[model samples]
Target: MPPTLQSLDHLVLTVSDVDATLAFYRDVLGMVPQSFTPTGGTARWALTFGCQKINLHRAGHEFEPKAKMPRAGSADLCFLSDTPLDAWQATLAVHGVLVEEGPIRRTGAQGPILSIYLRDPDGNLIEISNQI
Candidate 1:
Protein backbone atom coordinates (compact mmCIF):
# COMPACT_ATOMS: atom_id res chain seq x y z
CA MET A 1 0.00 0.00 0.00
CA PRO A 2 1.05 3.57 -0.59
CA PRO A 3 0.47 6.71 1.44
CA THR A 4 -2.57 8.50 0.10
CA LEU A 5 -2.89 12.27 0.17
CA GLN A 6 -5.91 14.46 0.66
CA SER A 7 -6.59 18.03 -0.39
CA LEU A 8 -5.65 21.07 1.68
CA ASP A 9 -7.99 21.42 4.63
CA HIS A 10 -7.35 24.99 5.79
CA LEU A 11 -4.81 27.75 6.35
CA VAL A 12 -4.62 29.51 9.69
CA LEU A 13 -3.10 32.94 10.22
CA THR A 14 -2.50 34.88 13.40
CA VAL A 15 -3.65 38.49 13.02
CA SER A 16 -3.48 41.60 15.13
CA ASP A 17 -7.12 42.41 14.54
CA VAL A 18 -9.51 39.68 13.64
CA ASP A 19 -12.33 42.05 12.66
CA ALA A 20 -10.23 44.04 10.23
CA THR A 21 -8.60 40.96 8.79
CA LEU A 22 -12.03 39.36 8.35
CA ALA A 23 -13.24 42.48 6.56
CA PHE A 24 -10.27 42.36 4.18
CA TYR A 25 -10.75 38.70 3.43
CA ARG A 26 -14.52 39.07 3.15
CA ASP A 27 -15.12 42.52 1.66
CA VAL A 28 -11.98 42.84 -0.43
CA LEU A 29 -11.39 39.26 -1.37
CA GLY A 30 -15.09 38.41 -1.57
CA MET A 31 -14.84 35.48 0.80
CA VAL A 32 -17.81 34.59 2.98
CA PRO A 33 -17.62 34.46 6.75
CA GLN A 34 -18.19 30.91 7.83
CA SER A 35 -17.94 31.19 11.60
CA PHE A 36 -16.43 33.08 14.54
CA THR A 37 -15.83 32.43 18.19
CA PRO A 38 -14.29 34.02 21.22
CA THR A 39 -12.07 31.59 23.02
CA GLY A 40 -10.14 32.64 26.14
CA GLY A 41 -10.90 36.28 25.26
CA THR A 42 -9.45 36.13 21.74
CA ALA A 43 -11.61 35.96 18.68
CA ARG A 44 -11.25 33.42 15.92
CA TRP A 45 -12.87 33.93 12.55
CA ALA A 46 -13.18 31.50 9.71
CA LEU A 47 -13.86 32.43 6.11
CA THR A 48 -14.49 30.49 2.95
CA PHE A 49 -13.48 31.43 -0.58
CA GLY A 50 -14.19 28.86 -3.25
CA CYS A 51 -12.87 25.59 -1.84
CA GLN A 52 -10.40 27.24 0.53
CA LYS A 53 -11.10 27.94 4.18
CA ILE A 54 -8.97 30.60 5.82
CA ASN A 55 -8.91 30.89 9.60
CA LEU A 56 -7.92 34.14 11.29
CA HIS A 57 -7.08 33.92 14.94
CA ARG A 58 -6.67 37.04 17.03
CA ALA A 59 -3.30 37.48 18.69
CA GLY A 60 -2.73 39.83 21.65
CA HIS A 61 -3.10 38.55 25.12
CA GLU A 62 -1.24 36.75 27.84
CA PHE A 63 -1.04 33.49 25.98
CA GLU A 64 -0.53 34.93 22.52
CA PRO A 65 0.99 38.39 22.52
CA LYS A 66 1.86 40.37 19.39
CA ALA A 67 4.53 38.91 17.17
CA LYS A 68 7.42 40.50 15.34
CA MET A 69 7.05 41.48 11.70
CA PRO A 70 6.92 38.46 9.46
CA ARG A 71 9.82 37.84 7.13
CA ALA A 72 9.55 39.71 3.84
CA GLY A 73 8.35 37.51 0.98
CA SER A 74 7.04 34.91 3.40
CA ALA A 75 3.57 33.73 2.49
CA ASP A 76 1.28 32.41 5.18
CA LEU A 77 -0.60 30.89 2.30
CA CYS A 78 -0.89 31.31 -1.45
CA PHE A 79 -4.15 31.16 -3.34
CA LEU A 80 -4.54 30.29 -7.01
CA SER A 81 -7.32 31.72 -9.15
CA ASP A 82 -8.68 30.72 -12.48
CA THR A 83 -9.54 34.36 -13.16
CA PRO A 84 -7.35 36.08 -15.74
CA LEU A 85 -4.20 37.74 -14.49
CA ASP A 86 -5.15 41.24 -15.62
CA ALA A 87 -8.58 41.06 -14.08
CA TRP A 88 -7.21 39.81 -10.79
CA GLN A 89 -4.61 42.55 -10.76
CA ALA A 90 -7.29 45.18 -11.40
CA THR A 91 -9.47 43.76 -8.68
CA LEU A 92 -6.62 43.87 -6.17
CA ALA A 93 -5.80 47.43 -7.18
CA VAL A 94 -9.41 48.47 -6.74
CA HIS A 95 -9.24 47.12 -3.18
CA GLY A 96 -6.10 49.16 -2.48
CA VAL A 97 -3.95 46.04 -2.33
CA LEU A 98 -0.45 46.98 -3.36
CA VAL A 99 1.31 44.75 -5.87
CA GLU A 100 4.92 44.24 -4.82
CA GLU A 101 5.77 43.37 -8.46
CA GLY A 102 4.91 40.91 -11.09
CA PRO A 103 2.70 38.88 -13.30
CA ILE A 104 6.26 37.98 -14.15
CA ARG A 105 6.80 35.01 -16.42
CA ARG A 106 8.36 31.96 -14.83
CA THR A 107 8.86 28.27 -15.37
CA GLY A 108 7.17 26.05 -12.83
CA ALA A 109 7.20 22.33 -12.16
CA GLN A 110 3.91 22.16 -14.02
CA GLY A 111 5.20 24.40 -16.82
CA PRO A 112 5.10 28.18 -17.42
CA ILE A 113 3.26 30.58 -15.12
CA LEU A 114 2.61 34.24 -14.42
CA SER A 115 2.46 35.65 -10.87
CA ILE A 116 1.86 38.77 -8.84
CA TYR A 117 2.65 39.18 -5.17
CA LEU A 118 1.27 41.41 -2.41
CA ARG A 119 1.07 41.71 1.33
CA ASP A 120 -1.88 41.74 3.66
CA PRO A 121 -2.37 44.22 6.49
CA ASP A 122 -0.45 41.92 8.81
CA GLY A 123 2.50 41.80 6.42
CA ASN A 124 1.73 38.29 5.25
CA LEU A 125 2.70 37.69 1.63
CA ILE A 126 0.08 36.65 -0.87
CA GLU A 127 0.91 35.47 -4.35
CA ILE A 128 -1.68 35.31 -7.06
CA SER A 129 -0.38 33.14 -9.85
CA ASN A 130 -1.77 31.31 -12.83
CA GLN A 131 -0.47 29.00 -15.49
CA ILE A 132 0.40 30.80 -18.69
Candidate 2:
Protein backbone atom coordinates (compact mmCIF):
# COMPACT_ATOMS: atom_id res chain seq x y z
CA MET A 1 0.00 0.00 0.00
CA PRO A 2 1.10 3.57 -0.53
CA PRO A 3 2.38 5.39 2.49
CA THR A 4 -0.49 6.96 4.41
CA LEU A 5 -0.27 10.45 5.73
CA GLN A 6 -1.23 10.91 9.35
CA SER A 7 -1.35 14.64 9.95
CA LEU A 8 0.19 17.98 9.12
CA ASP A 9 3.60 18.55 10.65
CA HIS A 10 4.47 21.95 9.22
CA LEU A 11 4.00 24.39 6.33
CA VAL A 12 5.94 27.26 4.86
CA LEU A 13 4.77 30.84 4.44
CA THR A 14 6.61 33.16 2.09
CA VAL A 15 6.37 36.75 3.25
CA SER A 16 7.79 40.13 2.31
CA ASP A 17 8.78 41.00 5.86
CA VAL A 18 9.78 38.28 8.27
CA ASP A 19 9.71 40.47 11.37
CA ALA A 20 6.23 41.73 10.66
CA THR A 21 4.99 38.23 9.98
CA LEU A 22 6.64 37.04 13.18
CA ALA A 23 5.00 39.85 15.14
CA PHE A 24 1.52 39.10 13.76
CA TYR A 25 1.70 35.40 14.49
CA ARG A 26 3.47 35.72 17.79
CA ASP A 27 1.63 38.69 19.30
CA VAL A 28 -1.75 38.70 17.59
CA LEU A 29 -2.30 34.96 17.32
CA GLY A 30 -0.34 33.97 20.44
CA MET A 31 1.86 31.51 18.67
CA VAL A 32 5.35 30.88 20.00
CA PRO A 33 8.31 32.04 17.96
CA GLN A 34 11.28 29.78 17.43
CA SER A 35 14.61 30.57 15.83
CA PHE A 36 16.94 28.05 14.33
CA THR A 37 20.14 28.05 12.36
CA PRO A 38 20.72 25.05 10.20
CA THR A 39 24.34 23.98 10.03
CA GLY A 40 26.19 26.47 7.84
CA GLY A 41 22.89 28.11 6.89
CA THR A 42 21.13 31.40 7.56
CA ALA A 43 18.90 31.78 10.61
CA ARG A 44 15.23 30.92 10.21
CA TRP A 45 12.04 31.52 12.14
CA ALA A 46 8.89 29.49 12.70
CA LEU A 47 5.65 29.98 14.59
CA THR A 48 4.65 27.01 16.65
CA PHE A 49 1.44 25.96 18.41
CA GLY A 50 -0.22 22.71 19.37
CA CYS A 51 2.29 20.38 17.79
CA GLN A 52 2.39 22.20 14.49
CA LYS A 53 4.50 24.97 13.06
CA ILE A 54 4.62 27.40 10.14
CA ASN A 55 8.04 28.28 8.83
CA LEU A 56 8.60 31.82 7.62
CA HIS A 57 10.63 32.54 4.54
CA ARG A 58 11.41 35.93 3.08
CA ALA A 59 9.79 36.11 -0.38
CA GLY A 60 12.87 36.69 -2.53
CA HIS A 61 15.05 34.54 -0.31
CA GLU A 62 13.07 31.34 0.15
CA PHE A 63 15.05 28.19 0.72
CA GLU A 64 15.27 25.57 -1.96
CA PRO A 65 12.50 23.10 -2.89
CA LYS A 66 9.75 25.64 -2.30
CA ALA A 67 6.45 26.22 -4.08
CA LYS A 68 6.63 26.80 -7.81
CA MET A 69 5.29 30.30 -7.33
CA PRO A 70 5.84 31.16 -3.70
CA ARG A 71 4.40 34.55 -2.98
CA ALA A 72 3.36 36.66 -0.04
CA GLY A 73 -0.30 37.26 0.81
CA SER A 74 -1.34 34.23 -1.20
CA ALA A 75 -1.99 31.75 1.57
CA ASP A 76 -5.26 31.01 3.33
CA LEU A 77 -4.81 29.13 6.58
CA CYS A 78 -7.23 27.93 9.24
CA PHE A 79 -6.25 27.32 12.85
CA LEU A 80 -8.28 25.64 15.59
CA SER A 81 -8.56 27.19 19.01
CA ASP A 82 -10.29 26.14 22.19
CA THR A 83 -10.95 29.79 23.06
CA PRO A 84 -14.48 30.98 22.44
CA LEU A 85 -15.25 33.07 19.36
CA ASP A 86 -16.34 36.07 21.39
CA ALA A 87 -13.12 36.07 23.34
CA TRP A 88 -11.24 35.77 20.09
CA GLN A 89 -13.03 38.82 18.82
CA ALA A 90 -12.02 40.72 21.92
CA THR A 91 -8.42 39.70 21.48
CA LEU A 92 -8.48 40.71 17.86
CA ALA A 93 -9.99 44.05 18.79
CA VAL A 94 -7.19 44.65 21.26
CA HIS A 95 -4.65 43.86 18.56
CA GLY A 96 -6.40 46.03 16.01
CA VAL A 97 -6.79 43.18 13.56
CA LEU A 98 -9.98 43.75 11.65
CA VAL A 99 -12.37 40.87 11.07
CA GLU A 100 -12.83 40.43 7.36
CA GLU A 101 -15.78 38.15 8.11
CA GLY A 102 -17.03 35.39 10.34
CA PRO A 103 -18.38 34.06 13.62
CA ILE A 104 -20.06 31.85 11.05
CA ARG A 105 -20.40 28.08 11.19
CA ARG A 106 -17.96 26.07 9.15
CA THR A 107 -16.64 22.53 8.94
CA GLY A 108 -13.32 21.79 10.61
CA ALA A 109 -11.03 18.83 10.63
CA GLN A 110 -12.64 17.49 13.82
CA GLY A 111 -16.20 18.68 13.36
CA PRO A 112 -18.31 21.81 13.05
CA ILE A 113 -16.50 24.97 14.04
CA LEU A 114 -17.28 28.63 14.62
CA SER A 115 -14.73 30.80 12.86
CA ILE A 116 -13.45 34.35 12.52
CA TYR A 117 -11.47 35.62 9.57
CA LEU A 118 -8.69 38.16 9.44
CA ARG A 119 -5.57 39.05 7.49
CA ASP A 120 -1.97 39.04 8.58
CA PRO A 121 0.59 41.74 7.88
CA ASP A 122 1.46 39.99 4.65
CA GLY A 123 -2.25 39.80 3.80
CA ASN A 124 -2.48 36.06 4.29
CA LEU A 125 -6.05 35.08 5.08
CA ILE A 126 -6.28 33.73 8.61
CA GLU A 127 -9.16 31.76 10.03
CA ILE A 128 -9.32 31.17 13.76
CA SER A 129 -11.98 28.75 14.94
CA ASN A 130 -13.40 26.88 17.87
CA GLN A 131 -15.23 23.56 17.78
CA ILE A 132 -18.97 23.95 17.91
Cα lDDT over the full model 1: 0.71
Q: Pick the candidate with the highest lDDT.
A: 2
RMSD per candidate (Å) reads 4.2, 1.0
The whole-model C-alpha lDDT of candidate 2 against the native structure comes to 0.92
Best by TM-score: 2
Report the lDDT tens digits of candidate 2 across residue range 1-132: 999999999999999999998888989899999998878888899999999999989999999879999999999999999888889899999999999999999999888999999999988899999888
- What is the overall TM-score of model 1 with all chains considered together? 0.75
**Distance (Å) between predicted and true CA of 127, model 1?**
0.5
Itemize residue pairs with steric clashes in candidate 2: none
